[model samples]
Target: MTDDKTLGVYDEKAGDYARLMDHDTIAPTALNKFLSALPERGTVLDLGCGPGSWARYMVKAGFRVDAIDASAGMVEKASAIEGLNVWQADFSDIQDVAKYDGIWANFSLLHARRAEMPAHLARLKTALRSDGRLHLGLKEGTGEARDSLGRFYTYYTVAEIRDLLARIGLSVSDLRTGADKGLDGTVAAWFTLTAHG
Candidate 1:
């Protein structure tokens, strides 16, 4: 589990945090692509599902979705959404293994410390079915810390992410990077990685 102090930061800003993401557009597109590649519909886990926007979308798309987040406020918000099964848990605290067909970790794993990424990636793999697909996104660069608004973040290079996946027994099927300019003038080097066990 995340420390009490870190969870407090997210709890304080869960609403603003939900407002920051463009889930209506970005989430559907990403999820559609991920689902299209799958052989069949299966249980999906929305890892670090902030306010459960993606989880809600997945449910609407006919996929069973279980979501988890560290913030109580975020969990509360997500739990209120009809048809979403949201849990209040941190990635580091996850112990279930080989239980999901797909895991969506959009822009969330970036918050993990760089040194802790490999182990976390392995944990994700352990939570997946043998043929499970993983869709991950992260900011491109190096460093770690909270932003001005108190949300934690970390950046990664393509090579670094690829290596982590490889070491954790996931084979990278696709990787792409591009610039996404947000309203705040932050040009994020975003990437989508498709991997399988």
Candidate 2:
């Protein structure tokens, strides 16, 4: 993401964010399901991996994990996890082709601008091997806005997201939606979709 305010907030509150999304509470059901869909020991990319919670879990599960986040503070925290290869990078920096067996983009692409999502998703699709899986999490709604914490968000309804993914050549296989309290202390509706490239 290029938004300075959003990156700054995550930079300053990296620890708080990490603690809030603690290991066990970071959507284990969806995570484990995604893992089960992947080939054993398959390479994975934790795109926009904040605090590396998911990445760390995948590493422990024996996946080769490459994690990246835009916030330096987030990178610092994630880098500390043994066996995780992490770095500071924006969504636009993703350029690999047919390299990963799965891509975990939970709650991260929402930080991107609305106009940039298609290109970003395309890059992710291109980076995946045939039948590679992609797990995406996004706030469910329409349009874009800033959160209480000054972080930018681009929301999409289920249909909108499904169509977008289809246009990008990702076939949706599973979807789940719910409301949850985030680090900003307010409840928001969100959705997760599992797709294959």
Name the candidate that leads on TM-score. Answer: 2
Worst 10 residues of 2 by lDDT: 19-28
State the weakest 10-residue window (summed lDDT) of model 1. Answer: 180-189
lDDT of each: 0.78, 0.93
What is the TM-score of each predicted model, taking all chains together?
Answer: 0.88, 0.98
lDDT (tens digit, per residue) of candidate 2 on 36-95: 999999999999999999999999999999999999999999999999999999999999
Clashing pairs in 1: none
Say which candidate scores most in lDDT: 2
lDDT of 1 by residue, 1-197 (tens): 36465567678877866777643355566778888765565788898898887888788878888899887898998998787778888788767788888999987787777778888888888888898899998888888766554556778888878888888877886676777753234667778888897
The residue pairs in collision within model 2 are: none
